[model samples]
Target chain A: MQLPVLNNTPSQAEHGAKGGCSASSCGTTDNQMDSLPDSIREKVQNHPCYSEDAHHYFARMHVAVAPACNIQCHYCNRKYDCANESRPGVVSELLTPDQAVKKTMAVAATIPQMTVLGIAGPGDPLANPERTFETFRRLSEEAPDIKLCVSTNGLALPDAVEELSKHNIDHVTITINTVDPEIGAKIYPWIFWNNKRIKGIKGAKILIEQQQKGLEMLIAKGILVKVNSVMIPGVNDQHLAEVSRVVKSKGAFLHNVMPLIAEAEHGTFYGVMGQRGPTPDELQDLQDSCSGDMNMMRHCRQCRADAVGLLGEDRGDEFTLDKIEEMDIDYQAAMEKRKVIHQAIQEEMDSKRLEKAVKAQQHQQEPKLTTRPVLMAVATSGQGVINVHFGHAKEFLIYEASPEGVRFISHRKADQYCGGDSTCGDGESVLQLTIRALAGCEAVLCSKVGYEPWEMLEAAGIAPNGEHAMEPIEDAVMAVYKEMAAAGKLDEKNEAVRANA
Target chain B: MAVSIIDLCVNCFACEPVCPSHAISEAKPHFMVDPKKCTECEGDFPVFQCASICPIEGAILDSFGVAINPPGSLTGIPPEKMAEAMAELQSH
Candidate 1:
């Protein structure tokens, strides 16, 4: 499939220099804009956080999709409504990728001004990689125009940056409080990586190194990087200038210095122990101090993980999960609607090529496989047609058949696999559960199945037959059984268990 | 009696903005209503402002283990009535 072009373009020095438009100067050259890759241009224009001017005209919505954090920061407590508030760990609703896509489409439709879709976190986005990337992949196809951005604490960024680039994620916000491990230790208590907890300065050092490495990798790929520093009073406040210098030298596009929200109510390790927050003047002074070559982002809202609407003005309440579910909105349809439109255009182009190829080959027909009978499972919507998707199929119809006839033996009920929502369960665990449910069956016949689950099922000795054919389930089952029998692979019981073994 | 905010509280600030005793404060999981200061709006208002203004039902609970603002409270359509209405609509 041809990649969709990113529509929004930023005419900034960062776009010129850091985006590989020009290496020598910050100013845009005559051919710089034209020479820039689609990913960088699209990200620069649509991401409100990166483009200061876009903040005024274009709105961005954050879906609190990632709900797990790999590291513990003294300032963070990842619950509450981070989408509506500016804090990192707070979010009103935690959505799975499916839910996030639905909500994003709904919000985007209702609010025409929304141009960017971001996953900022009630927790570190990369901490929950599966949910985070699945959302991105879905959104890339469903809402291609909406620029994608993700904010992480850099703990999991190293492992995730390459994947993020693959998804065409244009903007990344890495919260790097300080480069110094001694200072980082004061901010972050522990980091959970590779299934081990490294605490104190050691954890801080590892996190810092990873964050820097991740930042370099992202910039090398021409992905715009935004560094966010929470100006913690008496902690990393004095060292933010050095942070800006380091990140800027490493090709960070912008630096956002937000004041630390050290309220007594949060009972944060720092807050309870009377850690003070930087004053407005102190924050401004820090930003000003670092306001040299690196563009200083002075108007950060410190948005919540599930924040919606424009920057500074939060409209999260209007689109709460319950309210959205109640609305007569076909979110799945809305997501698919764009794809159908795009497919129509693609199909039209391919039709000519297909016709030419058919003319050249004279449309030679391939011979069918020999007839045999074997027991197999078939997923059908209704009327004995293989119509339903494998993941969404709730039940599989078991049939035992040969070349002569087929018999409906029984039906096995299985859980519907959902990818986006963590509440449903991880895709791997869910797929395993599904495979176990279909144990003893030689093969499963469905209209379509995802590649990942298909391979997994194949590994477990179950063949996934995805013909996506509009034929009677009996015919489909009989054909496969006949082929097995013809190959002399069917057992005495007319099943493929022995052949598969 | 003080009203307590459970984890279900979305932290929409509906409760915090309308609290009379200034008891509601943002917390880690959700907004917390201070039992020390919470009077359940006994003298402040006829209905608790936080509970009344909350969008999520059953998010705020009174000390008696009952939801001050139960589901259908935000929409003002009781669950039973809504179900009946839905049933009637589906029957058609």
Candidate 2:
């Protein structure tokens, strides 16, 4: 089936809207993919992590075959028994190359949506070169249809690039937290180089050089490189903009600035030291600041090393080595089934995009409602839907709705008010903090909200809305704006009365 | 004694406004019980308002931290069976 090209050009009305975004700066996946060459688009068209839209229809799985890391980061605590933790370095079970291939085949047979197989380890993939390459080599020959990718810490990346190019691996992710050695020293305590453990500034310097070199070499070899940076507050947060700039200039296809997961129970060095992760607001702001230079991936779920199923959900427990060994998978029939399912999904998505484009064009022809844009806050856990609960939201995506269209403004971080039952003693203060964080917004849209916050938000002049639960955030914001306009509550004269109401 | 909304509460907004003391306010992850203001429906109603309206089983606990609505009370689906059913559904 021929895929439909996305229509991302902004309508005239949208261009005339206040704080309007140009096609390039709109930050929608459609426009981002449209700008890329056909070659790169084909590579990321079905890879869930690489394209935001692909995640909705396609699923990806990771194999935890590589269990040796060359560098030690303060934030990393690679736990083998952590079944509940959903972070990077935690895997319930480790598999050998043969077991990994068997598991992948079983998953592919069961999950028709599985399109990409990645080797992002509980440790760096490149560090365990033989095991990683062996798994890749076998999979490439046996399951040649599945797109293969690898993620590394870049300590062994420069050395392994030539071997990596030999395999069918087209996508490579390097965790380049910072280009500056000073900030890198704070994150990486030591790196094993030249058969010795090197520590402090000197170790950081060598790691950064290798990462930059590895990134350049992969790009030169026509492989798409995605740079993953952990945003550690006060450590690398302020310096990540420079990292983004450097990576983008060096031809990194996408930059994913992920927040540092520093919960104290994780028992990492930073967590034990009481180092807090970046607030969602800070992470979004940094992402927005760097987005001007290149495409930023905002939909990363930070999957576990052995994560399975779709982006948000994990089904790894069902596909353990024992389970795979017991099951007989006819991969030929499974591939045929997958082809039919994928083609149907593509056709449905193409029609949906076409309908959306037509609606946008019609919206541009409509008469203007008002020149002033109403700002509203949306609670979302990604996928562009208002699907999060009010009290559960760590941050709210702010949107500006005017006569033109709804445009995303920025993210406002809120202190999570409800910490379940064990930590309700500080609820009142946290709610107050959350309210203070959303001072400027006129309404808060979420899937569900408790009554106390409903009253409190209304009292504070910000309307709490749960009616549009699970709706696309932009459509919901525009609906609220039109509701206000239809009620004559959007004019300057009714502002006071509207707030009081 | 205050009735606490545990992690099992789905933030369904069923118990918040029903609280006579208005002690069941919103919080991150789930709702809470404010110890200072909670009357537990004493001198107002015969039973705890929050516990009466809550939909999830074992979501509301008493002062002693024992669940007022224990498992299998509300949904009639046993916790073990519910887990099995949910896992079965998600596998597809």
Candidate 3:
């Protein structure tokens, strides 16, 4: 799943200039590639949907193993084979978890580019908890290298995310069309929850709350979350931008605005009742408008539950249930091997956590600096610390600090760095607005900052502290002051801030 | 199973009450027929009960991919007969 080198793309420089990406070569051989944290790189390296570069090279497959759904939506018709139609929840056959594992192994062996296995069903994966978890539990051990992905409607996600994390399911996609229950009612007809059926706006409201809660929980646990929004015309078409805003604020890695497929043939209520699918131009316009300060995935094929091979191409017919069942496979031996693999993965994760803990302890023991602290800014959603990414930051909370203490100064509104209209401006222009918002700050601390903004800030003599840690604002300010004091650069930073002010 | 709704279901719910096996139930996108509970309306009706009442043409297919309620199933007129009738009507 090796991606082509950045030098190969004619628009590589333009992409780097966009301000979100770092200007390093996209080649795996480069030193800059090595500098990326293993957690981040490994998550993106082989995952086709997550990594734009890898989507061309690597491939992913979805197993239609979950056959039960708790909610009813106007757009879905699970009875139809989702594979042939270009929408979610269409599978020719629904396999048991065991059968699913065998199919996955067979596909992996045949297709070298198949690096990801997703469980996006003809039904919500979370609704069929036992089957979905069983498939993940076996795959986590059997195909550890094949990144496990799941797409849910988020109705059952709040209860399922913790167990999903235990199975080491790193990537999760939640299809959230709208945040407004009034609008959601038009999309989702009813939901079965807590042994009762709730209908209309009430059910939609409950679903919205649960989805938001599940999103925040997943983000807090550091799971790579992607939101899939089906652009339902005359229902939530005008509302997806708000969906984009909310999900991006909650730290969704990508928002995929898919078009509604309301063909009359698919016994779906929407199709039967004459709900029209968005035109190509209408879909594009909605996506453009919803692009608010977040990355929007435009290449989604709206794949079926049993879709295989690359995003655009369908290779599902070759790996049918009948075909996989005929193969000479050693089921008993595979199970035995899975146990050993599970043990090894557990040991590796344990060692990594231990190493991280030791490094943090040592970092805390470093000496403090005596340099006077000038104004510093932090991007945070909560009032406490710098945990949000710079691109997602709507405002920056300013803080003033000295060797003695750190104090909250004021908050400044910052322009949305991503999303909204594409023609409003480019990333470089937005970076300038951000810099202007942080006027006299010596440095701005954030959980992450893109390459363009990093370079722009450096040129402006405003240090960009892009540390991927959720540290308290006071502690972060003090640590920076101590580091600057140790390097004999504290006075220099303070002078720059004063001169700029 | 009596009749299975493929992806072509329009979810009109016209066939739900007609199934005597009680296999058909409300489901996402359309309805589902539980294979274990289905008897294909053996004792309940002469024709496949669910398909007999289904409104959408070719919406219900049997295990052999033959539509239980194929096109013209509702009108009770074969395509050939319909063509002949149209020819007769034009002459009149």
DockQ of every model listed? 0.02, 0.01, 0.04
lDDT of 3 by residue, A1-501 (tens): 122221233354335432332322211111222223466556764466654334444678999877666677778754465333556777787788999999998877666567789998767788778888999999888777677999999998999978988986888899899999999888876676554446689989999999998988888888878788898888888888778777876777567788887755565667656679876447656765564212224435577788888765568888888999888765455545544653554465345335433433343343434566677788875424478898888777666555434544444657632234333333446668778768778788999988988998888767889773587565687677566667776665455454443
User: Which is the better candidate, 1 or 3, if ranked by lDDT?
Assistant: 3
Q: Which numbered prediction scores highest in lDDT against the true structure? A: 2
Residue A481 miss distance in model 1 (angstroms): 86
lDDT of each: 0.65, 0.74, 0.67
| Regions of candidate 1 where Cα sits further than 4 Å from its true position | A1-46, A79-86, A293-296, A326-501, B1-92
Compose the digit string of candidate 1's lDDT tens values, residues A201-286.
89899999999999988888777887888988778888898897788778776677788876534535555455788654465467
Evaluated on the second chain alone, the candidates' TM-scores are 0.76, 0.84, 0.72
| TM-score: the better of candidates 2 and 3 | 2
User: Which residue segments of model 2 deviate by more than 4 Å?
Assistant: A1-29, A79-81, A293-296, A364-474, A484-501, B1-92
The 10 consecutive residues of candidate 1 chain B with the worst lDDT sum are B69-78
Q: Give the Å error, residue B78, model 3.
A: 28
Candidate 1, residue A494: Cα displacement in angstroms equals 95
What is candidate 1's CA lDDT for residue A371? 44
Candidate 1 residue-wise lDDT, B1-92, digit = tens: 77888888655453564677999886897789889999877776776766654545587788898987565533333566546554554563
